[model samples]
Target: MSAHDFNPLLDIPVFPASGFAPLADRLKRIFATGNDLLFIQAEALLALEAAASSLGRPGLVAVNVVTSPYGTYFGAWLRRAGADVVDVVAPSGQPVATEAVAQAIEMLGHVDLVAIVHAEAANGALNPLEEVAALARAAGALLVVDAVASAGGHAVDIEGLGIDIAVLGPQKALGGPVGLSLVTVSDRAWAAMQSVPRFSPSLLSLLDIKEAWLDRGRGALPGTPPPLEFHALAAAVDRLEAEGLAARITRHQRAAKASRAGLRALGVEPWVADDDRASALVTAAPVPDGVDASALIDAAAAFGVALGRGFGDIEHRLVRLDHTGGRAAFGPVLANVTAYGAALAALGQVVDIGAGAAAVTAVYGEA
Candidate 1:
C-alpha cells in the first residue's frame, strides 16, 4: 500500500515539531534540560558506539550480563565496535550481582564502559542500576543503560542513576509504534562521542546525529522522519506525563502483583527466582507440568489474547505475560487473566477461573 493510502497509524511524520522537536524536548525535560542530549534514530547502535567512545577505546569493556536477548546483541555490537568485552554473567531468571560487576571491573583495571540493561523483557528480569552505576563510577567507567523495556514502564532518572547514555525504544512500554528509538546523552558522553572516529555509517553515527541535532534544530538528518510514530510517541508521552510517572509505575507494579498472585494460585511459579529482579512489563512463568507452552500460546490466540512464548533458550518451558503499556489497567488485567484461564481449560489443564479473576479483582480493589 502507498504511504498515503496506509492508515493514520502507519504514516511517518516530519521532523522538528512533528518528529524530532517533541522527542528532543521530552528527552531534554527528562534528562536535565541544560545538558547536551543527542537525538538519534538508530539508538541501539549509537549507544554501543557511545559506550565504546566513553571508555577511550580501553582494551577491555565490562558488561554486567543477564539472561537477556538484548545482552547478546549489545555484546556483539560492542565487540564489532572494537572493544574487548568481559561479561559478568548472571544465571537465567536473575539479575546480575553488583559484586560480580565490581569484581570484573576491578580485575580489568581501567575498563572503558559498563553496559547494562535496566529491564530485560525477554526474560522478565530487571537489573539493579543504582548500585551498578556506583560500581561503574568507582571503576572509572562510563555507565551505559539499555532502558528500552523499562523507560516508560517504570521510573528512570538518568542523571540520578549516573548513567552516561540512556537508550530507549518507543515500542515496548512507551505504548508507541516501533522503528523510532531515542537515546539521552550526557555532556561527557557527547564530548567522548565527538572525539571518537566515525566507525559507523551516517545513520548509525552518534557524532553525526549529535551535530545534526545541534546544528539543524531537530530536522538535522536527511530524509523525512516517521510522522505517525512521532505523533504516537508524543501522545504516549503526553499520556504518561499526565498520568504521572509515579502513578503509571504504581499501576504496572499492581498489575504485576496481580499477575503473579493469579499465576501462583494456578499452581505456577515465576521463572525468575528473585522478586526484586522482576520487571513490571513482562513476567516469565513456568509452564505447568504436561503443558506445552507453544500449544498454550496458540490456544490463547484463539481466545483473542495473544500470550508471548518464552524467547531464546527458554522457549517451550516458559510463558510470558506482558502487563505493561496500554495494558496496565484493572480491566485489561482481569481480561488477560480470564482469557488465560479459559485457554488453559480448553487445553485440558484444570485452572481455577474464579480464583484468577478474584486475584485480579483483589488487586484492583473496588476500583
Candidate 2:
C-alpha cells in the first residue's frame, strides 16, 4: 500500500491540539468533578505514579490501602518518594475493611494522605470508599483514589466525597483507548503538591502539567499529543453521554447480579461473599479442588468463550469473569457463566448447566 493510497483510517485528519483542554473538560463532566483536571499522554498507572511523586516527601505520613496490585504499586511509589507509608492490607479476594483504615489512622497519630483503590478489577472486589473518605476527612488527611476500574461501573462523586486526587483510566469501564489517562486535582491537593520538590521537569511531573497546560489558559498540550488516543477518548465520552451515566452503572450492576446468580446455581460461590463488597466490573470464583485453573480456562476458550484468570497470587486459585464496558450485557454475562459451567462439566465436575443458565436469564428478566 502506497503512503498516499487514501486509506480512510490512516488518512484521517489530525486531532486538533487545541481541543486537549476541552477534552479534559468533557472527562471532568463524566467524573462530576469541580477540581482541576489534566490528561496524561500515557496509561493511568503513570498518572497515579505522578500523583504519588508530587505529594510524597519526607515527614509525610500516608495510609495506603492494599486490596489489589495497583494499591501495592501506589504504596511503593509513595515510599520511593520518601513518604512514611502505613499499609492497610485486606485478605485475598476481599476489600479492606473501614475499621482497619480507622485503626491505621488512629495508630499513626497524624496522616498527611490516605490512598485507596475504589475497585479491584483484578480480583472483583469493591472498597468502601465513602466510609474511608469520611475517616480521612475527620483526620484532616487528603484523600487520593484510584478510580480507573470503578468510575463508570460505580458511582464516584469526587467533589462530594472530598477526594483530593483521582486517577481515571477510560479503557476499562469507559470503553475507551488505553493510550491516555485523566487526573483530577483538588485545590488542597495542589497546595500540598506545591511543597514537594521530588518531581522535576520530567514527563511524569504534574507540576509541569499545571504550569504548561492548566495555568497558561488551557489550550493545546505542551508536548506532542497522540491524536489517535485523543479522538478515541472523545468518542468514548460521546457514547457515555448518549447512554447516561446512571443507566450505564445500572447495566453493570445488573450484569454483576446475573453473573452471581448463575455462578451460585452452578454451586460456585463468588470470591467475595458479600454482594456489596463485590465489584460490578468482574465476578471471580475460587477454583474448585482438583481442577486445573489453566485447563478450565482453556476449555472455555475452546467453546469460544473468553475468560480471565486472577492476577498475582490468586492467578492459580480463582477464575475471573469479566463483565465490563461492552461485555456488561445479558448476552455476555450468560455466555460467561454458561462457559464456566461447561468448562467444569468438561473437567469432570457435576454441574447443573441448565439450572445455571435459567438462573442467569431469570435475573436479567427481573432486571
Candidate 3:
C-alpha cells in the first residue's frame, strides 16, 4: 500500500490521455450513426440538461412529451430558457401516443423542437420514438431523445430516425459506469446550435465540444476527461459488440416478455398494460394491496435479490423489476421473480411459487 509498493492499478494510466478520441469513434459506430458523438464527464441527466440548455432559444416553439419526471424537467428547462413549450403529457404507466404528437403539431402549425424520452424506466413504458421523430421531421423541428435506458436494449438510429440529438447513458442497458454521458449530434443540430447566440461559456456547451472534435482535428478532447469511466465504457462496448446488439436486444425483449407472463401469474398488475408499450429494461408492477412495498423489497433483499425502488407518487404502491444488461440473462430473471414470489408468500399473499419461475424459463429457454 506504500507509494511505490507494486500497486496493480498503477500501470493503468489515467493521464497521458491518448485513448480518448478513438473510444469516441468506437461509440459512434455502436450508435450506428456517422454523426459527432461527445463523451461528457457526468451522468446522462446532466447530458440531457446540457442539450436542452444549449439548444433552447427565445421565440422558439417546441412540443414536449411528458411521460415521467425527466420529461417534466426537460420542459421546464426549455421554458426557463424562453422557449414557447407545448407539453403532450400521457397518463401514468403509459407512453405518449403518436397521434397525440401529430395533433399537437397540427394545432401549433409550426415548431422549432420536439423533445421526448425513448423509454421510461420509472413506470416501465416505452415511447413511440420513430413516429414522434417522423412528426418532428415533417414539421421541420429538431428532435432530442433521452435514450439512456433504451440504448443497448432497443434500436436507436439517431440520423436515420431524423433525431437532432440523441442522448445515451452506459450505466443502465450497457452495463457500464454511471459517470459518463454520450451525446450524438446530427449536422442539422450543429447548425441550429451555432446560429443561436450564447448565454455564456456554459460547461454543457455542445458547441465547444464540437469545436474540439471537428476543428481541432481528431484525437482531441476539450478539457480533462474522466479516464476511469472512459475505459469502462470501452470495455462495455467491446462486450456488447461481441454479444451483438441484435442478440442483446433480443435477450432484453425475452426478459421483458417473461417477466410480464410471470408477474401476471402472481396476481400483480403490470403498470403498463401493453407489453408493446413497456420497456425492455424494467418491468413495473404494483405491490399487492396489503403488502408494504418497503417490507417486500426488504424481503427480496434478504433472499439476495435487489429490487429497484419506485419513484414519484406511486413509490409505495409499485416495485421495479430491473432486467438490464448483465441481469437480462435467464438466471437473473428467474432469481428476481422467484424472490418476489417468495416474498409475497411470506407477506401472506396467495402466490404460486413454481409458476412465476416456470414462465421465465419457458420464454428464455425458447432458444
Per-residue lDDT for 1-367 in model 1, tens only? 6656866454444545545565667756754535555545443445544444444443545564655766766677667656788877777657788888878878878776788889878778889888888888887777788888897777778877778878877677777657667777777777666655575556666666666666666554544555565666678777767876677778888877888777766655778767677888987777777988878888888878878777777777777788878887777777677777788889898889898888878877844
Deviation in Å, model 2, residue 23 alpha carbon: 1.9
**lDDT tens digits, residue span 84-195, model 3:** 9999989765799999999999999989999999988887899999899888989999999999999989998887898889999999888898999889888888988886
Q: What TM-score does each of the candidates earn?
A: 0.88, 0.98, 0.95
Candidate 2 residue-wise lDDT, 229-321, digit = tens: 888999999999999899999999999999999999998889999999999999997788999999999999988887899888788888889
In candidate 2, how many Å is residue 86 off?
A: 0.7
Ranking of all candidate structures by their lDDT, best first = 2, 3, 1
Better of 2 and 3 by lDDT: 2
**Cα deviation of 78, candidate 3, in Å:** 0.7
Clashing pairs in 2: none
Q: CA lDDT, every prediction?
A: 0.72, 0.91, 0.86
For each predicted model, how many residue pairs clash, with residues at least 3 apart or on different chains?
4, 0, 0
Q: Which candidate tops lDDT?
A: 2
The total number of steric clashes, by the backbone 3 Å criterion, in model 2 comes to 0
